[model samples]
Target chain A: MGRTADYTNERCSVAATLEVVGDPWTLLILRDAFAGVKRFEQWQDRLGVARNVLAARLKTLVSHGVMETRRYSERPPRHEYWLTEKGLALSPVLLTMAEWGDRHVYGRDKSPVLFRHKTCGCAFHPVLACEACGQVVDRRDIERAGPQDLTAPTVGEALDAVKIAAE
Target chain B: MGRTADYTNERCSVAATLEVVGDPWTLLILRDAFAGVKRFEQWQDRLGVARNVLAARLKTLVSHGVMETRRYSERPPRHEYWLTEKGLALSPVLLTMAEWGDRHVYGRDKSPVLFRHKTCGCAFHPVLACEACGQVVDRRDIERAGPQDLTAPTVGEALDAVKIAAE
Candidate 1:
């Protein structure tokens, strides 16, 4: 427990994202949103989560722009939750996690759900590719450029220029 | 709080994966491994984390086959941690989270350690495609069919023929 509870100490993007949505509940809530569940009660029902916790997670996600709130009905001002562009960007993360789970945890059972690439017409395997190249990356290909670059080019240029993979 | 903490409670693959590596430090440790930081002290130095927490995370990852432990040197019996093939599969998840953080937390100033497609020489965006037509996917185009497949199959099987996407 001596480790600082403050997750901000780590200066990595992965850590930062975890600080916000790494919790079990947060990811689950996001899953429900993708499943088309929006109303507060609906999220609570599908997830079987505590009302208070669901409320808090929803507030945090909305504030963080991982999700957005809109009125589904006008009379009483009822709202529905939807993934914003930012939230939709999380599709890869969620899909990857689910695929991993399917392999290790659900080894014997069929993947109750599968992610199909609408274009490829096959089961989608989420991969990291070099935007510059189109190769499937393996280890030993990436290099360590710090979050800040240390070249004559301003740190911004260096940072922007970092293509860890061929891309 | 009301949501079941265990993934086995649900049949979802994402839920299953969370049951194992969903803890906070697990992925961080894996991230360090991918970055080529393997020794316990190096991990501590880079992560600025408590010794016990790092040890525990390493242990969990190894036990789950997400990581492997090997003696770095003979004299001291000192060991280094490394990712297994299973562990390497996490690249997509890590990339997704990193991209999410770069967008939300870093905004324009922060950017992903660009991933290039070694073969293509362009920035690669992992697009979910249709297995049937090899077309890119949008929400309106697909329907869910769970492994159980108790529900009727709609004609527009544009998406993967998995379980119905539960609502």
Candidate 2:
């Protein structure tokens, strides 16, 4: 299949994020990283992904700072991939995707993997909640603002805006 | 680029879900659907995606029951695509992705489009929480279990297991 054009110039945040981890291969690779699979050969074996493709995806992740490489052995110069904070934050996305699949696709009563809340020591389903009011957020609660002026600010400006908004 | 092999036979719920919505283009189309872009033309205009690819994606979503086409005009025989319940369930996935982009990719002070918790009437950020105990779930709280038997059960068996587990 032909690769789609990059969304580098797109102002949508989703598009921007997709630029980094939107591809299925990339997401699957991240899934393995979260599962504690590190070595290159391990990813290839577990995912059954093409060697070149896996190599490419890993390289992209490292370049984007989602994953970091560490040398584990000196004899053969072995390296392993690990998730960074930014990458770890993607857990919600993965969990939610799995939950959806379990409910709609798998028709399963329980998920293949269950998530436990360490603080409470109970199995839990992840949900979206409002940070300000701590209320669950639904589709009806969201709307696109500045729809006509969809051009998003540059990354620096966005960071500044977030800071100001926080204040 | 060659397409990755399908995970249709995979027993993992995540892989199953990826089989449906894992591709970047497919996910992007879903994102547009959530954003209220329904018509084929509108999607083309907004996404700049190839016509054949867009058509294929729309067809796939419709076939999977994520989207349904309704005739809006009989004279011109035009149809508009709308999200089904299963499709609407994907809101969290899209929101999480956009939120990720806002925080990491854009470095924005806030998301370009803000999500409001309509029930609470407050701007919100989505968070993962445990359903069993209602505690917030952190990265450290999660671990993969039954790694030796990664294969998940069929729908019927899974449902039965869930019921038993509940007891």
Candidate 3:
């Protein structure tokens, strides 16, 4: 299942995003790419993923505009994969996942890698906040706007039409 | 593949996290669960996923302690899935993905659903920030500690050993 597995008609943004980077191998590849592992053989050696699957994933990511290939050497015509602007934007997603694993999977004392904020020189964890008020938001702090029914008529219009029909 | 597909030998936190909820369908099912779609039938209806796949995903989530099943109806013995504390902690990961999609996949002008911070009554976008300094941390503003090699000896001992070997 490549790009065709996308939930194209789904009205959810998360679903849309998952369609692009939802698979484990893809996510691992992206993680490795962020860690400066660019060569195809390096990724294969690092991830232990099958060559065909890696090739397909690289192709899918490139097609999705998440990554781009560049030729570094002309002798053997070697190409390396690099994250595009869109792909770099996924850093937070991966960071949050690692943080979650650090907290839940491995105890806090045994984190594999620590993320330090260069500005503050303090090791820190990522948090979701209200961009407007800068308040840390949790599931309870957030509310969904409305039902995401793309097939249904707008609620207000539907209600008005029903009222008119009754009248 | 189910839980057996996990990269258990990999010491990376991100890889550990991926082992839990890496598949596209599992992520979609978790998305639906976060949206308060608890009933099995509701997940089936919302995701349009095959029954067997949905069952496997739900079972994996339960085994991983991300979700739990509750007896919702005693008459028909119906059960509903609910996110555990560990699962709810994944909100940031999901929210980040949605925000990325809102920016890159779907234009900002046409978001499917909006997330509002109930505490401040303001719409919010999730951002990755340093928990200590409360500053937004970009990829350049952060540094990875070191290679997450499980096989590596302790850093201090390994360095001493390397020096001894060199001597």
Question: Which window of 10 residues has the lowest lDDT sum in candidate 1 chain A?
Answer: A157-166
DockQ for every model comes to 0.28, 0.46, 0.40
lDDT of 2 by residue, A22-68 (tens): 77688778877878899999998888889998998998888777888
Instruction: For each candidate, report what fraction of the true interface contacts it reproduces.
Output: 0.42, 0.63, 0.73
Model 2 misplacement above 4 A: A119-121, A145-167, B119-122, B148-167
- Model 3 misplacement above 4 A: A1-6, A149-167, B1-5, B149-167
What tens-digit string does per-residue lDDT give for candidate 3 at A126-161? 887777787766778888766665753332333234
TM of each candidate vs. truth:
0.76, 0.85, 0.85
Order the candidate numbers by DockQ, best to worst.
2, 3, 1
Which of 1 and 3 is ahead in TM-score? 3
> Candidate 2, TM-score vs. the true structure?
0.85
Model 1 chain B lowest lDDT segment of ten: B154-163
Error of 3 at A54 (Å): 0.8
lDDT of 1 by residue, A1-167 (tens): 01233455455667767867877678888987888788898887677878987888888787667788998789978888889887887876887787676655554225667655544455655545443343445434554343433223322232234322115
What's the lDDT for residue B7 in model 2? 62
Tens-digit per-residue lDDT, B96-165, candidate 2: 8888887786664455676556676665567876666555567678655435345666434543443465
